[model samples]
Target chain A: MKTPVYFDYAATAPVDPRVVEAMLGLLGPDGDFGNPSAVHAYGRKAAALVEEAREEIAALLGVAASGIVFTSGATESDNLAIKGAARAAARRGRHVITEKTAHKAVLDACRALEREGFEVSYLVPDRGGRISAAQLEASLRPDTILVSLLHANNETGVLQDIPALAAAVRRHGALFHLDAAQSAGKVELPLEQVDLLALSAHKFCGPKGAGLLYVRPGVRLEPLLHGGGHERGRRAGTLATHQIRGMALAFRLAVESMAEESSRLAGFSSRLIEGLCALPGVLLNGHREARLPNIVNVSVEGVDGEALQLALRDIACSSGAACNSASGEPSYVLRALGRDDALAGASLRFSMGRWTRVEEVDYLLERFGSELTRLRRIAGAA
Target chain B: MDELHDPARYSPRVLELFDRPARLGPPPGANREGQAENRARGSWLRMYLQVEAERVVAAGFHARGCPHTIAAAELACEALTGSDASELAEYRAEFLEAALPLPPEKLDVRLLIEDAVRAAAHGRR
Candidate 1:
């Protein structure tokens, strides 16, 4: 069977071999099978493994080890960060601020918060999936206590100016939580002023079952899962030793190799951009030059994004809109850019990853160009 | 490791299953009937097929998705021939198991094929 090229890395990445190797020691009966809470030698060994993993993950983000709390993955980390922070600081303020296009985890958490009677100011991002810092500053109300913005958009790969946004959020003394699921290992973020940050290991080539929430000093969160007071009463469960160890290894490898990896993915992503741009009536979506190095979103007029995706099944790219392929509904991110639904619906997001290569990009460029040309003609596009 | 997104060990059948894509819209002449067939690509919905057929022959698909999707639909139609709607409903991964593997992301293409089958069942000429 021919191996298909994978371009949807933002959804989740394959675990790195380094991570898989690191996890092996924790899996077998002879490994660290002792429950972390058991004070015996075995338990102590397990506890040490968990703590060491914590330190490694924290160090990757430049945060104190104590601030890192491991969870099942990014979704849980996001839930814990947003919902926990909202509850922990609820008395200080009842209003929370966040932007649209946040991963569903953040948006859903905010929605849940609203259900619990907290008022949330949903910031509509500017075109390119950016929520303006000035708009955020203006949206601040005295009652607002937490501001959560995604560090990088999952769909568009648009990187938010976290430090600038964080600096503004600080003025109101509102706690800031950045959902760094897309950025933590892919790019460096300013840790200062980011009260809490969430990351999932899978986004950075780690195991899917492990993730961490960075709660800066003095920032506290109510536990999401209740048990034997694991994670200092924040998240409760027997630690997932293998997954946690794998995540730590993944983070270390990603942090150490981020520069070269970023450069490689940038080249790959631009290759897609250049290739897609060569198609007539093609449009590039997202903030030009302001997005993550690996993401290239574009729209070919008269070609349905999903249809194009279907045509080029040999290359596993993505369409931003979930609706029908023939009928055009613009991408929500593109719509935020004031593009009518047609342009938005026509948008496609192609993200490059560590495994991406020039050969794969070449195949993708060839397949995509032909697919668009064929789909246009088949769809009767004049 | 199969523990992750390992496409490495994917068998020919598994690869074909993941890669073979069905169409998203019904065939060109399908909508004239009471049923409007919508293919989701992985799972198919054939509602309102209130009768049984002795001999069935149909030509379909207005390619709405991609080459793989169109090919998958064509493959589905060919496979479903000489079979009844009930037989069509039970069509499993074999067609694709014989074809190219479907990607995890494009798995919906399979459902679209099923939808085409149902559309063909109640499908109007």
Candidate 2:
């Protein structure tokens, strides 16, 4: 049987073959498999590979290699960036600002801080799932130590104006953190404007288990992990040299081909949006113009999102609700934008990526239209 | 591709019922109908039954929910048809739960199916 067409790139992308090949050179007996912390020659070689990987990632983000600190993945990067910074700046202030639509990594970190007597203000986004610069400025207070937000939403592909928002945060005398896990390799990032940024390798065709947090010079953070002074005392752990190498290679490839890939994806997204919107009772989620090119989220009226997802078993996609859980909560991001539970629950996120083709998009459109019509008919929608 | 997918996430029986529901949609000229929903969880079910001499002669269901809930609804309709209406009041979610071997978190699906059937029986009385 033919496998299902993958359309959940927002969740995670397959590692690029080039990245895999690079990783293979660092993994086995003949490879640079020694611990990076060892003082031996093999260890030195491994450490060199790690530093080279860091440079590749730094080059893509337009930041100095020294600013990057590797972690297990974005979740750890987010926790380290937010919690570490918030705790370090606690003496100066106890307040923080973030949008409600941010990934759970940021929100949960903020929530953890809240338990420690810190005040967090979750800014509500507009109907298009966007937080304006004015909104950020208004939310910032004298005690606001940091403002963390996503560069691009994982579910809706909504892109925030990071430069404008960063400027607003800085003007308020607060540090700005961008969870660029979703947008790192997909688009250009204004790294100079952000004080701290988090990224994941798996999101951009790198192997999983490795990510980075870029800390701007002069910024102080309370280390989340303490021991052995790894990551310049910011984080402590034996780095996975192979994973880091793969990430660097993946980031390099993504940056090298970003312009052309983005253009191609934009065309595919446009075709998908056009086709989906032509269906009766279909509504697109998020700002049409301010979203990433690879993801198109839509809500089909009168259809259950779970049923639709099941109907489209041949197309791997995600619903706006957390389908993995029993509660099945509609995406908080959509809810923050004022979408009702039913509409949010009915939304589907079709994310395309490097391997996506025009023919697959057409097939998906047809499948979606037919399944939606069938489901609506069964539901007796007018 | 197999590595990319997880088959164990869904039981084969649930997949079978979801792929080919035995009693989907409303039975023609159903004498009794009932609807139940767990709006917070986005699960909804509408059940129709034809009763003759206090016995369910035919049954069908239409549901919009996850695979477990849909499968449960279909399975309920299959189990209830040709049974005495009084059996509905005694119907327990455990029977369906065991048959489907539903996860603990998905016990709500069994309850939803039971609610639809009981509602249908109540309407007939």
Candidate 3:
């Protein structure tokens, strides 16, 4: 059987062949496979490669190589940034602020802090899925030590105004942390304004299990792991050199192609939105103009979202419905936007990526139209 | 992962039935009809049964749910068409559970189908 057409880039992207080639060079016996911490010739060779990879990743964010701390992925980076920063600044303040629509990594990290006598204020977003800088200013307290927010929402693709929010956080004398897992390679980031940022390689066609957190010089963070003095003692583990090389290559490639790729993706998104909105009761879920180019989330009327997903089996996409989840609840991100359970359950997220072509988009539009018509008929809506 | 080991995602039977559902919609001249829904999960099933001399002559179902639920609903309709009307209650959760080998998390699907079948059977009685 043919593979389903992949449109779930927001979930995870396929590893680019160029990235894979770079990684394979560092993995075999003939490659730089020695531990960076060792003192042998092989170790020196491996250590140099790791440093070069660090610089490549840092160049994309316009940050210093020394400030980068490698981790397993965005979740780990998020945990290190939020929990580590909050704990290190506990004496200064125990209050932390974050948006309601942040990824689970950020929200759960804040929640864990809340359990440790830290007060957390979750700022609710406007209906357009944006948390205004004014909202952040209002939520900020003298005791607020950190404010964590996502640069782009994974589910809705809504882009936040990080520069404005960072300025506000700075004015209030608190650290600003950005979860840029979804936007790192896809959009331009204001690195100088953000004190801390988390990025995952897989979001932009790199390997999984390799990510980094950018901690500005002089930013204090309590180390989450303690052992060998790796990642400047912030995170401790032998680095996966192959994965790191792949991530850096992918990040660099993404940066190189971002401008052209973004415009092309925006066109695809517009076509998708136009075609989907033609169906009755279909509503766009996020800010029409402020969201990222690759993602389009919409809630359809008069059809069960899960059934529609199944009907569009040829299109590999995701639904906001919690049918696949153990809790069987609708998407919390959708619910945060004031959508009811039914509407939230009916939402679908279509995220296109580098490999997506116009023909595939056209096919998806036709397939989706037919499936929605069939489902609506079964539900007696048409 | 291989399809044989990952029972949680999709089974061949479920995928086959979902791709081309059998006994969908109310059959013509059906006397008994019942509907069941799990509002939280957005699963709905409606069953139609035609009974003659205390035996089910025909059965059909219309469903708007996940692939597992749709397949289960279709399977229930197909299974009950030749079954006795009095034996409807016997087609409980375990019966469908064994047939579909559905993931444990999807037991609610079985309940929805069972509810529809029981309702249609009661209406016939």
Question: How good is the docking of model 2, by CAPRI class?
Answer: acceptable
Pairs with backbone N, CA or C atoms under 3 Å apart (clashes), candidate 3: none
DockQ of each: 0.11, 0.44, 0.42
TM-score of chain A of each: 0.95, 0.98, 0.98
What local lDDT does model 3 show for residue A110?
93
Q: Could you tell me how far off, in angstroms, the CA of residue B57 lies in candidate 1 after the best superposition? A: 19
Residue-level lDDT tens digits of model 3 in A40-83? 99888888888999997887778899899999899999999999
Model 2 segments beyond 4 Å from truth? A326-328, B1-9, B52-55, B85-94, B121-125
Deviation of model 3 at A209, angstroms: 1.6
Candidate 2 chain A lDDT trough over 10 residues, lowest sum:
A373-382
Q: List, residue by residue over A1-382, the lDDT tens digit for candidate 2.
A: 2448888999999999988888998899999999999999999999998998888788778889889999989999999999999999999999999889899999999999999999999999898888999988888888999999999998889999887888898898899999998887789987999999999999999998999999998889899898789999999989899999988888888889999999999999999999999998899999999999899999877767777777787888888756743445777778788888878878889998899988899999988888886666555453
Give the per-residue lDDT digits (tens) of candidate 3, residues B29-108. 68888888987776788888988787888888777777788788878777787777788755585677777768887888
Error of 3 at A266 (Å): 1.1
Report lDDT (Cα) of residue A373, candidate 1: 66
DockQ of 2: 0.44
lDDT of 3 at A354: 92
Residue A250 lDDT, candidate 3, scale 0-100: 92
Q: How does each model score on lDDT? A: 0.72, 0.85, 0.87
